[model samples]
Structures are given as structure tokens and as C-alpha cells.
Target: MRLEEIARRLGLEAAVAGKGMAAEVTGGYCSDLLSDVMANAKEGYVWVTIQTHQNVVAVAGLTSVAGVVIAGGHRPDEETIARAGHEGVTILLTPMSGFEVAGRVHALLSQTS
Candidate 1:
């Protein structure tokens, strides 16, 4: 599934979508720990996290994930948003919890698979 489709289907707000809207959603990763995501998140995966720090953008860039979903209605800081835009990292926001986001993402990917 495409990032655009996933965002639309999930009703995720494109908080900082400078680019990468067409990125593929190969899978999903849910974690609030940056190191865990850096170690395990794969390319094109949708990361579900509550972290709103700028380092989230850095890790997203490093992991090459399709997008980072700030769950539980948490919004990234201004600096983080700017960093995400500058890095072309698609930052999605949602009121759902990380568990809900992960389940929805899994269901979406499973359907496509």
C-alpha cells in the first residue's frame, strides 16, 4: 500500500509531509524507544510512536521508514516538524493509541499482502 493510501485510510493528519507521500507501506513498527526503532524498523514501514522529539525525525530518516505516525494525538514540536519537513520525512498524526495504529497498519498490510 502507498503512504498516501495508508494515511487516508487511517485518517492520519499529514503534519509535515514535505515529500515521500508516495512511499510504500511495506509493514509496520510500533515502539517509543528510538534505539529499538533504529535497530528494527525496516524501510517503508509505518512507525507508530508517541515520541514527539526531533530525534524521531532523525531515526525515521535513518530507518528509511515510509512515515512516522505520532499516536495518541501527540504532535511533534515545532523544531521536530521543521526537521521532518527538511528531511522529507512524512510525519503523520492520529488520535489513536499506538496499539490501535499498529493493529490497523497490520490489517492494512495483511490485506494487501
Candidate 2:
């Protein structure tokens, strides 16, 4: 499923839609620790985290993630959102926990795949 489709299905709020990021999501990964996410998340995967910090944007860039999903009803700081925008990484916000978002995204991708 496409990122936009997944966002709609999960009721995720789009915080930043940088360049072609919305067209890049092929999978999903859920992790709260920045280091674990940076190390384990695959490129083109929607990264689900609750950090909501500027470093999350940097890590998203490093991992080449399709998007960053701020879970648990958290909003990223202004700097984080701006950086994500500049880096062409879509930023998403959701009221669900990281695990819930991950599960929903995974289910969607599985069904579509």
C-alpha cells in the first residue's frame, strides 16, 4: 500500500510531506529507541516512534525511511518537523501507540501485497 493510503486508513495526521516521500513507503518498522530504529529500520519503511525530537529527523535521513510516524498522540517539535520537511521525509502523527500503528500498517501492507 502507498504511504498516503496507509495514512488515511490509520487516521494519521500528515505533519510534513517532503518531496516524494509519500510515494516511497514499502514497509513499516516500529521502535521507540532512536538508536535501534536507526540501526534496524529498512529504507522505504515507515518508521514508527514516539521520540518526537529533532534527532528523529536526522535518523530518518540516515535510514532513508519513507516516513516518520510519531505515535501515542505525540507531536514533534517545530525543528523536527521543519527538518523532516527539508529532508523530503514525510512526517505522520497518530493517536495510537507505536505498536498499534506498526500492526495496522503491517496488516495493510500484507493485505495489499
Candidate 3:
């Protein structure tokens, strides 16, 4: 599924609105630890986390994630938003918890598969 579709299906709002909306979302990974995500998140996976920092955009770029979903109604700071936009990493916002977002993403991916 595409990042835009995931946003639509999950009722997510764009925080940075990067240019990766057309990117394919192969999977989803939920984590707060940056190191864990860097090591484990697959390419094209929409990452679900509460860490709303510029470093999150850097890590997402390194891992080539489809996007970063800020769960629990969190919003990225200005620096994070700038970095995400510069790096072309889509940042999505949601009011749901990370677990809820993960479940929905998994269900959608499963349906597509």
C-alpha cells in the first residue's frame, strides 16, 4: 500500500507532508528506541513511534522507511518537521496509541497481501 493510502485508512494527518506519499508501505514497525528501529525496521515500513525529534527523520532516512507515524497525538517539533521535509521523509500524526496504529497498519498490509 502507498503512504497516502495508509494515512487515509488510518485517519492520519500530515505533520511534515514530505514528498514520499507515493512510496510503497511494505510493513509497519512500532518502537520508541531509535537504535532498535535503526537495526530492525525494514525499508518501506511505516514506523510508529512517539519520538518526535529531528533525529527520527535522520533514522528514517537511513532505514528508508515509508514514513514516520507519531502516535498518541504527538506532534513533531519544528526542527523535526524541517528535517523531515528536507530529507523527504513523510511524517504522519495520529491520536491513537502506537499499538493501535500498529494493529491497523498490520491489518491493512495483510489485506493487501
Best prediction by TM-score: 1
Query: Which window of ten consecutive residues has the lowest lDDT sum in model 3?
Result: 15-24
RMSD of 3: 0.9
TM-score of 2: 0.91
Poorly placed runs, candidate 1 (over 4 Å): none
TM-score of each candidate? 0.96, 0.91, 0.95
* Better TM-score candidate (1, 3): 1
User: Model 2: which residue pairs collide?
Assistant: none
Q: Write one digit per residue (lDDT tens) for candidate 1, span 1-113.
A: 89899899989999988466798788888999999999999998889999999999999999899899999999899999999988899999999999998898899889999
User: Relative to the true structure, how large is the alpha-carbon lDDT of every model?
Assistant: 0.90, 0.83, 0.90
Model 1's number of clashes is 0
How far out, in Å, is residue 81 in model 2? 1.1
lDDT of 2 by residue, 9-99 (tens): 8888989976534564778788879889878998889988889889998888898887888999998999998888787778989999888
Residue 51's lDDT within candidate 1 is 92
Worst 10-residue stretch by lDDT in candidate 2?
17-26
Clashes of each: 0, 0, 0
Rank candidates by lDDT, best first.
1, 3, 2
